[model samples]
Target: MKWEHALKDYKLYLKIERGLSNNSITSYGLDVEKLIGYLEDKHISVSPLNISKETIQQYIYELAKTVNVRTQSRMISGLRSFFNYLIFEDYRVDNPLELIESPKIGRKLPDTLSLDDINRLIAAIDLSKAEGERNRAMLETLYSCGLRVSELTNLKISDLFFDEGFIKVTGKGDKQRFVPIVQSTQKYITCYKNEVRNHLSIQKGHEDTLFLNRRGKQLTRAMIFTIIKQLAVKINLDKTISPHTFRHSFATHLLENGADLRTIQLMLGHESITTTEIYVHVDKSHLKSVLQTFHPRK
Candidate 1:
């Protein structure tokens, strides 16, 4: 099969069968595309199924020269998953990546903002521009709901169950969950909707979208990042923060305030409790507080 055809089918499989997000499918496809480009550059003609393991190893070697160790490890992992999918679909008899190894990288800790820092960031918004109202609401929703940037961009007006105090979030793999929205956050979002969004000329297919650009189109993930970066600079915060940092801080603060990890996991749309458990490490002092408050001997 042609490279394009293979990629298309693989993308469909990832979306429909594996239930991966669009961003994840694109990342997996890019890994395969890198291989195709390398073969073309070397004047070697080989299909995905026909490429030798040595070719992949050489590609990794070349990538190692330019990219950092973490990127090399991710590239290797992405390629490994692609080859495994081919084996699963019976397109290949065996997986060549089985013998290959990924480079070792240290586990990275999630960055979190303090409540004061978060307030400072939000306070920095100009609020003079029309989009400022929407940006404030977006950042509030992100931190309050612990939403991934993708989830924030795709959030719908219809998803808000204000009377019920919850918003329905469609997470990775189209998994749906109800996250509780605080009254304060609800007020900000409603203000944005009534004051800002109501006046915009929303585009077709985006009428239901909660956040919109000046063009009235749904906001992109990059736009969300850009907004956060600009806010960080305005506040002169030292931490290299991103939209995901708000999410981590949401979980971290919840844990620090004695909220249950399982509950936090559900709200964050984590598939496993273990993923939420990592927030516990952010504040070890919380453990001492828990023991002192709850222990019968104390």
Candidate 2:
């Protein structure tokens, strides 16, 4: 089949079978598109099923030069999954990227804000403006709930179960989980909803969406990043921070303060304990304490 037709079917498989998010599907599609572009540039006429491992290796070699080690690794993984899907569907007897290996890169720990730094950033918000309250609420929810920006943006009013102290978050692959919400966060969100959001002539489809742009629609992920970046700039913070930074900080802070990795994993909605183990590196002292407290030798 032509590359385009194969990619379209692959995206459908990702959405319907694998249940990947739109953003994830787009990223995976781009990896395949990059391979197609490389083939076109070289005037190589090869069908998806007929593409050779040698050609894929050459494409990867060219790709490595243009991207950082981590990005290259991710793209390689995406391509590998695509070929594996083709193999599963019986469209190909062999996978072109089966033997390809991702580069061995050091694990990059996430950046985090100190508690004092978080306070300073939040304090810098201009409370005089109407959006100030909204921004404050947004940032508070971000840090307090340890939510991804998408989860925060798509959060619906019905998801807030303040009486029970939890908010339902729809995470990657459209999986949903209930994460506990602190009263302080509940207070801020309630203030924003009752004070600011209720006043907007909210667009039809966005009535249940918790955070609305001034245009009375759901907040975009970029807008959330812009808010955090601008706040960082206003405070002259040296670190490059994003909504995910707050998430990292939340997990790190919890671990540093004696919260277990398993609990953090549950709160972060991680599908694997391995994903949560990254926090173990963030606090070596906490690791030492765990050894002292739990080891039979101790």
Candidate 3:
């Protein structure tokens, strides 16, 4: 089968069978695309099934010269998954990546903002501008809901069950979950909706999207990252903060204050409890206290 045809099938499998989101599917596709690009550059036209282990190893070695260890690991993992899918589909009798080794890299925890730092960052926003109210509301929603940047950007006005204290979040792979929205977040969102977003000339197709640009278009992921960067600079915060940083901070603060891991996992829209366990590193003392207090034998 042609590589393009195989790629299309793999993407469909990831979406329908694995239930992955567009961004994730694109990421996996890009990983394979990287290998394709390398093959083309080297004048090697091997099909996916024809690729050898030596070729994979050489590509990884070349990748290590230009990419970070974490990215190298991710790329290797993505290729391995694609090959595994080929085996499952019976396109290949053996996987070339079955013996490929990923680079050893330690897990780096995400940066967390303390409550005071968060307040300071919010306080630094110049609320006199037209987008000020909207910015404030966005930041509040980020921390309060512990939303992934994509989740916040795609959030819908219809999803806000404010009267019932929850907002529906469509997370990775379009999985839906209801996260409790505190009164503080609700109040800011309401303020933006009534005062700012209501007055904008919303573009077509983004009417229900809760956050919009001045032109009424849904805010792009890059725009969100830029907003956080500007705020971090204004506040003179030492850490390099992004939209995701707020999410990490949200989970970290919650864990520090005694929120359960399972609850945080649900709020963060993590597929597994282990994914949520990273926040546990923020407070060793708190985890110990919870263990000592809740254990029946303790």
Candidate number with the higher TM-score (1 or 2): 2
- Ranking according to TM-score, highest score first: 2, 3, 1
lDDT of each: 0.90, 0.92, 0.91
Per-residue accuracy of model 2 over 1-298 as CA lDDT, tens digit each: 9899999999999999999999899999999999999999999999999999999999989988899999999999999999999999999989888888899999998898999999999999998887888999988988888999889999999999999999999999999999998999899889988888889999999999999999999999999999999999999999999999999999999999988889899989899999999989988899899889999999
lDDT of 1 at 222: 95
- Which runs in model 1 stand beyond 4 Å of their true positions? 290-298
| Candidate 2 global Cα RMSD | 1.2
- For TM-score, candidate 1 versus 3, the one ahead is 3
Local error of candidate 1 at residue 257 (angstroms)? 0.7
Best of the candidates, lDDT:
2
Clash pairs detected, candidate 3: none
Tell me each candidate's TM-score: 0.95, 0.97, 0.95
Off by over 4 Å in 3: 291-298
lDDT of 1 by residue, 44-117 (tens): 88887888888888888898998999888988888888878788889888777889889888767799999999
